[model samples]
Target: MGQGKTSLVQRLYQRAVARYWARSARSAATARLAVLRQQSQKAQDLRRHLNRVIAVSQSRLALPLIGSNSFPRPHGTDWAWRPELWRQPLDRVGIASVANRESLGAEVTLFHDCAVSEVTLRQIRNTREADLAPFGVSMDVLGFDGSFLSLVVDLPDEAVRGLKRSHVIRLDTIVEQESPLEIFVRLNVKHGPNTEQVVHELPVNQEVNTVEFDLAYTKLNEKRVEKAWVDLIFEGPEMNRVILRDATFSRRPRAEF
Candidate 1:
């Protein structure tokens, strides 16, 4: 049968069952034995199917709404974005014992120098009212012996379109760590054969987690800009559980002096 017809039948069946229960509660004695027998038989036949539907419904409905791309952006912002991991569900929900050069989603990748990997990366649904993104990423680090660990997010073509040295790229994120840690944000702009990198120490301990990169400071060749990406470097992240509740990027022109 067609999906629409099947859904209609299910709704009608639910209405009839609801009415039956309401009447049964009022006067069970009024129910004839023949009708009761038929009702029992029908309910027994439908119980397994109904239970399956209920289970699937609960699982899907409990997740945050999908395809939510809206987020706060700065004034005069030409571009704003929340990475794919925070905007949609991944085919693979998580990774255990993540190795070097491993990736969670299409845009995010984990790179480390540890020999024996002891890290896990997972995508989680954000259900709190204060959460701006529909999804988040969680990382658990234990006994890490890596000299460097960072998550890289590749920006789409739109981020590099019409790029110029006059623009100031901004990074805003909400991170919760088990202990004190310093995180740094690096903006990489590939222009021609050379890549320009701008690094800023993310003030994660402050009330607001934000950092900006002024391209004017970097020797970026705007005319030859090809691609851009961001790196989130975690310093001394051993034995820590870090949840990146939200990460967003925005670009705006710097005000003239």
Candidate 2:
């Protein structure tokens, strides 16, 4: 009987040990699963933040370097300029159903005489290898019944400082259009009591369209030049999409005849 009792006690001890080990294993597995869930949640949150950072970085990196003021200039070029709209990003990216005297940026304004508005203006990033400027301006026109449509760009104060009659101002532009178009660049210089103006037709649908205004020809008052601007007039621009990829200015003295 004692031997039997001893055998039974051994069997009971074995079962109790087995039960304890089974419970410990379940607890360990539960703890491991909780740790896995916590790690997965953290990883997901990290991924979300990384994606946002990557998107913004890629967008900015894809564009041409900002604040780039480099362009080809003639020898002896006194002053060269790339407008703000082309050199950097604007506060507003685009506008639809544009109104008269609507301004795109601080420096550019749109003017038209249409009874109903049918124009859209947007700033687009230039990504092509041949584009020199970082940004470009795009215009969409449809069913235009306007007598005149023009985009005016106000020149900086430096453009008028030390003005003289012997200087020749050159306007260079790169334009892409859906069809053949006629465009004109009119340079206006404001003197004391009068404004001197000169108009030159641009050769559109070409690689580079350039026009030069010789101040020597215009009755420009040298001593009283206070401000200057350029008007880009579009003629019969109906049903057309025009993209002005680049617009730049440079000044040089005319060679003595």
Candidate 3:
């Protein structure tokens, strides 16, 4: 039989079993009815658990399974790094200072109105059982009362020129949350008076996530690019813990026509 045919037969059998159970319970004697009711309740609980398992399975199956050790680049990769899992010793991987248009690191900065007590940033060695990275940056937000909070990374000089109109920049990372909140990633490049930015919405519930920015469609003046940066903006992050498990960037030039 075909796969669909098998499913149809199984569904029919389930329905038949349900009908028989109902009918048998209805015709049972008082004592038998009590025992049957208990058994039925147990069966219902099992069914509920099974349904939950099915739902979880479907959700997991919906996303493509990506390997942890390596990222597959069908078109071939130009540049890639697992930032949060850096092998080299970083100078300052943590910035606990209150963020508000202030510089955080040599290349990283924070912009926010959150008080010092409300936020804490730390660089931690990934020692947890859930961590997939060797190193990570952890941000504990007690209360984010600011209108805007963003973590900015100034692109290196090489990126300002090496990034071409045909190149695609991809951001891959693992994010953990204390609660549900929407986060936005913005890729910025400044040509002159205008700063071109492309936003990517990151859904927080997924285990593995990636976002790409194609420069071909952007109005960026690649020749006149004076500066470049990337912004990781958090929205409604009050009372939340956000951990960057692993973040990497890969730039791939478009295939030749």
lDDT of each: 0.88, 0.88, 0.70
lDDT of 1 by residue, 98-195 (tens): 99989898999999999999999999988776777788999999989889999999999989999899999998888988887999889999999999
What are the clashing pairs of model 2? none
In each prediction, how many residue pairs overlap at the backbone (N, C-alpha, C within less than 3 A)?
0, 0, 0
Please give, for residues 195-255, the per-residue lDDT of candidate 3 as tens digits.
8889999987875688998888898776788877788899988888888766666778877
Scanning candidate 1 in windows of ten residues, the lowest lDDT window is: 58-67
- Poorly placed runs, candidate 2 (over 4 Å): 1-48
User: What range of 10 consecutive residues in model 3 has the weakest lDDT sum?
Assistant: 59-68
- Ranking of predictions according to lDDT: 2, 1, 3
- How close to the true structure is residue 55 of candidate 3, measured as C-alpha lDDT? 80
lDDT digits (tens) for residues 1-257 of candidate 2: 65446677788998996786566556655667776577567657967988999987776777567777888999989899999998889999899999999999899999999999899999998888688898999999998998999999999988778879999899899999998889989999999999999999988668589899999888887888899999999999999999999999998989886
Model 1 misses residue 198 by how many Å? 1.4
TM-score of 3: 0.64
lDDT value, candidate 2, whole model:
0.88
- Model 1: residues with Cα > 4 Å off, grouped in runs: 1-16, 19-64
* Candidate 1 lDDT score relative to the true structure: 0.88
Highest lDDT among the candidates is held by which one? 2
TM-score for each of the candidates: 0.81, 0.80, 0.64
